[model samples]
Target: MVLKNLIRIRRSAARAEAEHPALAAAGLLPGLEALPNAILVLARERLAIAFANPAAEAMLGMSLRQLCQLGWTDLFPNADAPAGAIAALREEASGTTQLDAVLELPQREPLRVHAIIGSLDAAPGYVLLELVENEQKLRTDREERILDLSAVNKQLIRNLAHEIKNPLGGIRGAAQLLELELGANGGLREYTQVIIKESDRLQTLVDRLLEPHRHPHIARDLNIHEVCERVRAVMLAEFPRGLTIHRDFDVSVPDLRGDMEQLIQAVLNIARNAAQALRQPIAEGTACIEFRTRVARRVTIAKRPCKLALDLRIIDNGPGIPEEIRDRIFFPLVSGREDGSGLGLTLAQNFVQQHEGMIECESRPGHTEFRILLPLQC
Candidate 1:
């Protein structure tokens, strides 16, 4: 819709150009600048950038003067589709064309965008290009799927836990009665004790699994940095000699309403996991974990849009998560380590979800980052 309106304005500018060419051109610029979508005008000769709006400047991470120094191919290096689209527009004199293309950036991931190209009637042999980022929509869709799956998984866990709790108690009680019947000095007492001890262990495991659902959320205004400090202290104490924890906080971020203890636990679980994964690095005296925070604007969580959000990242310089379990790290009973109980991330996710936040992770060979986004009222 925005593209259509901008195109219509260009046609109107062209129609009124005869007696008021300068005025028409002057009025068209403010309309483009006022728009939030990134727009760039390409010269027909070398396809060099003839104009760029403020949105384009921000999105492309370059000023109009800088953008003017580059051509379409420079901006989208080796992109065949966008090059073909420009070629067709010039040869056939097409009014408009649209395509999904990747825009390459310096030292950053390639941005996938929906590109709209139209002839600039106001300036012969020039075309206006509008770019709309597709990542936001894709992220929102992925969040929705995660939320849906989480709901189903949580319900299944609750039902399974309850079902296990009842029979589990009966089994434990039966073992106790058998133990009593056999008495302390009896031959079968050792086997009864084994049954009793194993049942108790399973009972403890079940309790941990059900703990998050049972705990009442206590909300209060809390500083996110304070929680990070607490987790850092705990992790450093555990891995004192080898590990170094760093803090990069946006102190300007305001306090948010949340369950402080739950937040601490969530952060600690992730940090502890990172510390454990950094075993080799720790032994080599090179282990590091960083707690970074920043303010994110115009963010979305669980399909709901927010004006502001707290972006908290826990990054570790260690061997990355094992690829096989990376995708299921947050799922219950899933763990990368052999002895891991596999409930830390699940509980962390649950705690964050209780405060209307979401957790996401990205990992490669030597870098792993866990990002938590919590919507802020401000």
Candidate 2:
């Protein structure tokens, strides 16, 4: 009877010590109770939730008590396990066992976890599970795929444009020669002249298509606002009479490294598009185009993080881009207006990308904004 009483006292003391906060502080209880990741603990005979972080609560959509009542096999069916054969092998192993597996929850999706089975200091038959989601890994894979596709598309455009350009120049030159020989009352000279003009126009389009590839970058330190101001002045001069152009500059934005001519051309393209959009509004005395600048930090472009970047927004309060072509507006030869060559936004995008930046457009019924995000020192 004395031996039995001593055994009971020792067991009670062990349980008390296991439940004490000192154990938690000492990191003996998995140290995951305060973490934000989903976790669970189980014993051999019956499963009890030893700890769960906030992330676990949010992920499994369950409370502490609710999860404790459920068994590992019940929460995750054996047939649906990620490492089916490995889990069975671990379960049948001799001493301490481990299984890297994924569990699919009823409310939530599949969760990747490393299940570790071993003896706690006092609890001999307990197991600890460290669950971590694979969502970020999957996201990274998707981003890599997108970048590969973008590169392939750009290469195809460059190759096709080069092939079409040489033949196009020959066609235009031949038409011009024919027109010169047919001069003086042949009247057929007019048709040759038309051919020459159309060919020249097509050749111009091809040149625009190849501009970004052919022009070598000439980068230097220059004030970004200076570039913006130059573009503004050009647009004002081109549409002097009725258009109202406003500058909302952030004076503190520092200088950027870029090719002056290319940056000017890129900004001019976007601003010119805005000016055209505002033509009817200008006639009605309600036309307004705003050039705004701001600083953005930790921006992600093309799946890469840029620490410090500059944002230039060209906003216009005119009839927005037509809804049908809005999605494909960045594609070469796709345009919203009848007379638009459809290469302005494309060229802008190409130049920005050359500077390791990105351009995006948002448009609604009455508002349209084209935002250019570029690295500050690149």
Candidate 3:
């Protein structure tokens, strides 16, 4: 009974120690590395990255070894002083401070992080910096907005398509009747033929607007390379003359579980969009498009933290997406080209969303890239 009591006391003590915050402050806790926020230890004088957690490494797109080789400025591509911030905190006696800052990395766009800079009570001149990316905080907001927009857009699309679908057949039949009444020799038949043909075109447009939402997502094991190859073949066949499609696929990326046909359509839509943008350049024999696939490490996609995701970029050297509709590119019925039905990207976004993925676009004059990120673990 005495031994049992002793064991029970030890277990209680263990739990107390585990709950202690001092271990984290002193850098003695292994659990610190497992947190979602990035942590870095910087020397007070040099403001250099002396130690980094796995999250920090992933956040900065640099290994700890690589980060330790350079000062904070050099490590975070386009960030200002990190250790200097910590040094300023040292003067406060508490040796801790919180600030919001933006950092630009080498491999990705800029990141806004909430930084907690502090020093261990036992370790002088050794600062512990805790960083939580705003991405995680903003993810839910972005996802909710996207979902709400998708729902509203879907309802609007269904209503509009159904509205157009009903009148389309009647319009075509009336045009046909008018054509028959006018007879073959009448010039007015040309006007009726135009009405029938345009009615068919409008019907086709309505069908495409409703297509992605209607189809049930048939999930299957999809080899990404096969999808890329299929898209490449289709694009090359269509724009065989002056366009070049380059492939930089990382074979290490594992197969993803998704609807093969839907995934194919999603990718093909983006690829074809890029190809179409290169219309003038393709004739100039200067058009180039690249299909680059790589693994995205430690990414949060669609509000879900994914240890790995597929990063597929369709890059084109054509004139960029026009600025007017760039923000509303994913919205239904928004189009840059006059002849464009504007449903291609909307359908593509819907298909990707069905697979728990997203399509992001970045464009400027002479360069346009549509990046698709899909979680591989799903």
Candidate 4:
């Protein structure tokens, strides 16, 4: 089906070239270069790419020169449905055709897209193919949910913290007063000391729960790899022997504007959590964590369109998150480990959201990944 469609496109291109030689040679329409969807034009003879817009280059992770070198088969290796739709358009009077298709770009995950194929009136010899990623809607919806959940968590934490704080202060003061009443060496002084100590511990917990609200966001231009390195150093220092930390950074990614300390703390919290989960692997000397950074183009975040974004991933080789708590990992007080404070991931999510970013996780036995997406241009 794809081959027959390619033949039809080639024949149409040949006819257009015969009718308007000059326009066919120009390859692309004037305004198509500025489009957000990945657009490509096929040549009159062999269905080779004659023109590719900037968005196409970004989507395919190639230069215009590189794309021109590929044939239709190279671009759509496992394509389906769209080819038949295009063939139908050629046979019928339809000016355009649309279908869902999978696009396999170089060294990237397979992209699901809604492909729109049509002919240009001015350059009829050329076939115009536009690809709009299907994940945009899903990403936007997920981001909205994250924002809503974060808002609810913030309100609940503030109210609960305040309620806990008032009683905690009173309890600590009353214990102090009682301790003084019974002399330092009195029989019950130790009991009063225990009460004061426990109160102080609870106060600390409350303070942590309210920390995100108390702190002001301070934005600065900083390199993401620097944050990764800082966290990597800390994790290595703490682990020292068995765990291995690796880096796969794209140095060309531009510096992002965000709160440096908050971002650092956010990444550190996740790394520390991963390290803690690697106890069994560490003992066997097979534990590994990798920090990878890349530039994502044409992404949607929090229902907003962004031309460019940062994709940072922290991947670990360890036992996966338990299925029972996996869905609630970011909820405060939820933990898979017995000794875990359960606030690390919650604080991490809050910090990332403050920078207009979102974090997503995927896990299975022996492989777990946390992806952080932050928009560079919206």
The estimated TM-scores of all candidates read 0.75, 0.61, 0.67, 0.68
Error of 2 at 41 (Å): 27
The candidate with the higher lDDT, 3 or 4, is 4
Any idea what lDDT model 3 has? 0.80
The CA lDDT of each predicted structure is: 0.85, 0.72, 0.80, 0.82
Residue 344 of candidate 3: its Cα lDDT?
Answer: 85
User: How big is the positional error of residue 15 in model 2, measured in Å on the Cα after superposition?
Assistant: 34
Quote the positional error of residue 97 for candidate 4 in Å.
Answer: 23
TM-score of 3: 0.67
True lDDT of residue 250, candidate 2: 93
Q: Cα miss at 198, model 3 (Å)?
A: 1.8
Ranking by lDDT: 1, 4, 3, 2
lDDT (tens digit, per residue) of candidate 4 on 88-177: 555433388787777776678878888888866656555678988887665566678778888998999999999999988999999998
Ten consecutive residues with minimal summed lDDT in candidate 1? Answer: 11-20
Off by over 4 Å in 4: 1-5, 8-136, 184-187
Residue-level lDDT of model 2, residues 284-342, one tens digit each, is 87888899999988766666777888999999998999999976777788887889998
Give Cα distance to truth, residue 286, candidate 1, Å. Answer: 1.6
Better model by lDDT: candidate 1 vs candidate 2: 1
Clashes of 4: 0
- Pick by TM-score: 1 or 4, better one: 1
Would you list the clashing residue pairs of candidate 3?
Answer: none
Name the best candidate (by TM-score). Answer: 1
